[model samples]
Target: MASPALTPTTPATRDVVLVPPAIAMVWTGAGRPHEIVAVPGVVLGAGETLVAIELATVCGSDVHTVEGHRAAPAPLVLGHEYVGRVIEVADGVRAVDGAHVQVGDRVVWSIMASCRECDRCRRGLPQKCRAVLKYGHERIQTHWELTGGFATHAHLRAGTAIVRVGESLRAEVLAPAACGGATAWAALARADEVADVDGATVLILGAGLIGLSACAMATDRGATVVVADPDPARRALAVRFGAAQVADPRDVRALTAALAATGSPEYDIVLEASGSPRAVQAALEVVGVGGVVVLVGSVFPTEPLPVDPERLVRGLITIRGVHNYAPRDLDAAVRYLRDRGAARPFEELVSARYPLAQIDQALAAASAGRAVRVGVDPRDAHRRC
Candidate 1:
């Protein structure tokens, strides 16, 4: 679709800045290569802001959508995990910390925008607001064509929870916080409700970005974490991120042995970050009495899980599923990254980097699952970080 003519920027008194056309890799449909286009000038409305994307990480969901494993709106901008500089902010827009947003501030925002007045928001479930507008999920519409992170510029709409991050943190370290990190924080928050993380025995089912994050956060809280993954490299990486023990998920004996070594016969909290059906069932069976199973990675369709009512009654297991995180969880994700990012090799997670023109290669690298997270820099195609 051809974009409209570029709009002129108003004066500083009107709180507007001139923004150049943005280069965007637009996803037209499943199994098709993204079309690279130069997006024309963007004019921000009330409670809106425009950002120049510095770096973005290709998320698992983005890979799934492109591979036709999941359905997403066609011709949408397909990235929600990114870090960028604020190029423009309209009146009444504030960060999640309640600080006034300013130009040139490096920031990350929640993937979904929720109307705070909705019933879901009033009930403390703002992430699922009836009128939620998620970044990278909606179709390309006029005046909001730069809604996702696969572009040089992103137009953030009202009700999006923005958070200002420190300049000291690298963009690669912070981009994934928008989705992977924030969702991990929410999953851990759910487990905390039934079983406290401090000094508890926790088992993480996958060693992907989210699982590694949970492992680090749980370890930081004094919990003993055991991470299980089929990949030896990921299992080794888990130790660097604070896993007490790492095991192959397919080896039931190894998982059981790891749990026993933690001085707990069963996990006090089991976080299922692998979307495999087998992992979901294993989460139920391995959780201790009164323990909670927080499922975060089963976003794709799979066969119905067979649950035994007697198991729930006798084991007293609490099963909770977390989708996108709350506004507060996004804040927690940033804080976690800021405080502990340097100590752990957070930068190592984004192993491969590509320029905006190479988005096809980036997505392929992510889909191959060879790297923990694949990065995209939307600046000059030849620019190196």
Candidate 2:
């Protein structure tokens, strides 16, 4: 679809700086692969900022979109995990935390942009607001065109909560904070409320980046984590991330049986981060009576498992479902990476790095379980870093 006429932007009470054109990777569909597209830069509109993305990571949901597991509009710029520097800031634009922002400040923002007046927003659930503009998740036919991080330059629209980042946070470690880290933080936030997360038996159902991030976060709380993954390599990484035990998902039945034999109750808290619907039932089986299970993954739809509400009632098991995250989760994600990034080898989870054009290969590596997460640098198409 051809975009309509471009609206002229007039900077508020200041001179507007025009940016130069840059390249971006636009998703065509599942048929072939994303194509390289040249994005023309324009004058900064009021409440919009142009950023140069330093690192954008391919999320599991991005892989799901390319593989047809998740439904997304075609021909959009499809990336969200990112860290970038502000090249231009529109007038009257302020961070969500009410701090003043300027150009050249390294920053990270929430994936979901919400209207502050919505009911959900008032209740502190911005991700589910009536009108939420999620960067990278939206179809690219709208204005500015480059809403995702796969591009060399992206436009930060109004309602985006911009937080200036510190040097203590590395791109690879902070990139996933937009989605994965915030997601894990949101899920664990609920788990921490009902149960004693510190020193509790926390079972994470996937050792992917989100799971590993949850592992690290749980470690900070003194939780004894036991992670489960079908991939042996992921399970190994879980150990390094402070998981006391790692089990294969295929052996969930056996693993649960072994736990039953111990006579101690099952896990006090279960986090489903595998993105597999089947893991939901497995999670039910593993969570102890009166324990809590937070569904953090399942961004893609799959076969439905039998849900027995009576069982939940009888077991007193609290099941919470976290879709995206509250805005506070984003703040916590950046803060955790800033404060405790060096304490753990969270950077080790960054397994593969590829240039923007090689995103297909990066996605392939992540899909094949060779890497937990992959990075894409938009400026250098040929270099892998």
Extract clashing residue pairs from model 1.
none
* TM-score of candidate 1 against the unseen true structure: 0.94
Compose the digit string of candidate 2's lDDT tens values, residues 1-385: 1111112232433333334456778888886777877666544556777788999888888888888877787778888889899888876777756777788888888886666676877898877777777788788753457779888877876667787886667888888888898888888898988988887778899887789889989988888788888888788888888877778777777557545543446789999998687677889877888899998887776787888888888989998888888778888888888888677777767778888878778788878767777888886742432
RMSD of 2: 3.8
**Tens-place lDDT digits, model 1, residues 83-128:** 9999888876889999999998999998987778767888989788
| lDDT of the candidates, in the order given | 0.86, 0.78
lDDT of 1 at 296: 94
Candidate 2 segments exceeding 4 Å error: 1-19, 257-264, 381-385
